[model samples]
Target: MTKALNEFLESNLKELKDNGLYNEINVVEGANGAEITIDGRKMINLSSNNYLGLATNETLKQAAKSAVDSHGVGAGAVRTINGTLDLHVELEETLAKFKGTEAAIAYQSGFNCNMAAISAVMNKHDAILSDELNHASIIDGCRLSKAKIIRVKHSDMDDLRQKAKEAVESGQYNKVMYITDGVFSMDGDVAKLPEIVEIAEEFGLITYVDDAHGSGVMGKGAGTVKHFGLQDKIDFQIGTLSKAIGVVGGYVAGSQQLIDWLKVASRPFLFSTSLAPGDTKAITEAVQMLMDSTELHDKLWENGDYLKEGLKSLGFDIGHSETPITPCIIGDEKTTQQFSKRLMEEGVYAKSIVFPTVPKGTGRVRNMPTAAHTKEMLDEALKVYEKVGKELGVLS
Candidate 1:
């Protein structure tokens, strides 16, 4: 490597470490369920996004194995070539039905779905009004489109309306689009989709919602779009199969014309290899399970409520979460990281969120209670939380 490149990387990494912004990844010894083993120790894991706990579901694992036996492991090529298998088509069809859309197209990952779909439809002449708290993938996707991005105040409808009116009246662009997350992951607040949709309609703006964190956890496992009964109104519904679905890949569900356009014009779909046969089969089975019963969904909410109440009873600032996601707020970044560390030492694994990821001085240890967590496991985790919080002077 060049001397300048090496020095640049080393200096940035040192800065990240000095500022407590560096991430240290942990390894799970076995399946990632309600509890995970790390470094020969077992802990109740509260840091995962496996909402319905389908990541380690036996049924989904069997489906994947069966697909591997019959179809092999890899996709072999990009979708436009020979990678579009019958399973991929079936997965897309099932996803469309689940999301209540006319058609759907799949990508290698949720990040890719955004990058591909956004750049495919939007152009330099377009302006995109995006939520300030939208995911990083959405920001990158907008950048790739070369569109004029206007950051609207997060979840503030009045601000969105004003910005949309200004951008539309300016006549500085051929088209305008509004994009946001169906559920804000950090704060666990559900977006005001109805209001956003109304605003978009008034301004003749295209609508896009990334429901990555809401699928399989809202609307009886349908999604936030279906949660608000605006399935037909939103122009684009993007979701991931990796989180609640417990598999891998991402997709966009919309009208047939939009899906066809993405299929042909999306660079990721045209150039990147399609999802593996095993992942496609597993994701299809997972979605079918979600459609078949609400058992997992209900259990997940039950656990979430139980955990939230436990944290609040202990006098921890759990934050205002509309969904199952819980955050134990700690005022300072160092103290927040220390709290998480002590919790892990006491047999609970909750990660800390600090600057850049969240606003300064609002550092929190985010918890995700899943359907697979038993009452006993949650109780134990609560006990650990109480112990750690008290030790850290976060509780009385």
Candidate 2:
């Protein structure tokens, strides 16, 4: 390595360590589920995005195995060059139905989905009104399109309306699109889709909703837009097969014309290898399961409410979350890290999220209680919280 590069790396790493910003990843010894093993210690896992606990479901596992036996391990080539397998077509069709759209297109991953979807329509001649707290993928997607991006305050419909009016009326751009995450992943608040759709209609702004976190959790498993019954009103319904769907991939569900355009124009679909056969089949099964019953969804919400109540009763500042995601807010960054570490030491694995994942001075240990968590597991976790909170001086 060059001398300058080595110095830069060393100095930056030291600074991060000193400031408690360096994230040390933990390895799960077994499958990620309601519980996980880290360094040979079994613990209640609360930091996963596996909202429905389908990651290790018997049905999904069987589906993946059967697919691997029938189709092999890889897609072998970029989609446009012959990698589009039978499972890909089926998954896209299912996604379209799931999201209540005319058609849908699948991508290799959620991040790539954003990269492909945004640039497929919006261009430098256009403008995108994005939520300030949208996921990083959305931010990069806006940047990649080379469109002028105006940041709307987090979940502030008034700000969105004002910006939408300004961008559309200015006539400086050929088109304007407003994009937001259906569920704000960190705070767990939902996007104001009803008012947004009203504003969009009044100003003729294109509407885009990336419901990655909301896909399998909201709308009886459809998504946040579906939760609000705005399927017909929103132009773009983007989602991930990874999070609540419990597999790995992303998709865009929209009109037939939009799907047709994405097939040809989205760079990831055109240039990247498609999803593997096993993962695709597994994801398809997961979606079907969600569509089949609301047992899991209902249970997930039950557990979420249970955990939030427990944390709140113990005098921990669990933020207001509409969904099952719970965050115990610890004001200082280092203390937040310490709180998470202490939880792990006591046999629970809830990770600390700090700047720039969230704003500084608002550090937190976010918890995700899935349907698979039994009352016993959650009770134990709450006990640990009580112990940690008092010891750390977070609760009196």
Candidate 3:
């Protein structure tokens, strides 16, 4: 009986190693900024999701330090068990105002926010109409909810309407929800929120958008829902503080009733420890900076455009990207991996995305252009790209 488990594990492990699909985690040795040190060597970083460069901002650092001095290091307990600090309340209020929602609730991480928020609302009686290319968190959340999941083609509004209409007509579900990523991290494409909203209204579907990548990159730094002016229509707006906000946590913004329900009902929020005081303070200051000035956002866009244009000029397939996340599409997985390794050896740190993360044969090297990256830094990265491309015979 025990032999089956050992044989299965050994076979699968050998298969993964033999297929060249096993991942080797790279150690990022310094701060996650535009440039970083890895294995005692400095490299221009294009793998981070810090779109606004807020992760390393001086103002945010100072705010976090100050909060630590005042509020100590940890919350010490779960939110329902005396972990909800004053700073947590303040951060929720700020998030509500920022997202233009009546209320908001924070969680330990964006992944947990999805896990908590999705299961809190939907159950076996409910059905979820999710985008096929939605994030892994959304998929896990849907699984956790035990809701019947109907996958619509990526960004296909007509397909979404069809599924929503069919699910509602059946009358088997207590509620129908439509969930999507406001900005898909892999493809860097914006979701069709306006069309989705119209369909959701027609079918009475609960609308949910995970704007993890869109926050601080779209709508002048608010998000894709705000970009499309659908704040009043979408029921749940899920976002992360770890990325553009430059801190650590996640939040769900919606009506006061929804937030109130999540406060007591969401398992992650009730069971997990609240965000630390320092993280809360840093995120709040980052949000304030985003609201007060568009300098970083504008610079991020400029840098994105410059990198995209440069890569395109060098005859690389940079896929259908509308945001700062650019993908240099190299079809074969081994080739793409080799290309990325070459880039790393040349002092540019961009990882490769192969099968499973993206469609098979659509392997790519994803690049993120942050505001902290100077033009010279980008230029140098491009030169490395050129050299690597030439060496690998990927470019003429």
Q: After best superposition, candidate 1 residue 113: deviation in angstroms?
A: 0.8
RMSD of 1: 1.0
**Global Cα lDDT for candidate 3:** 0.92
User: Tens digit of lDDT per residue, candidate 2, span 125-154?
Assistant: 999999999999999999999999999998
lDDT of each structure?
0.93, 0.94, 0.92
- What is candidate 3's lDDT per residue for 238-329, written digit by digit as tens? 99999888888899999999999999899998888889999999999999888898899999999999999999999999989999999999
Residues 245-307 of candidate 1 have per-residue lDDT tens digits of 998899999999999999999999999998999999999999999999999999999999999
| Consecutive 10-residue window with the lowest summed lDDT within model 3 | 15-24
RMSD of each: 1.0, 0.7, 1.5
The top-ranked prediction according to TM-score is 2
TM-score, prediction 3? 0.97
Query: Which ranking of candidates, highest lDDT first?
Result: 2, 1, 3
TM-score ranking from best to worst? 2, 1, 3
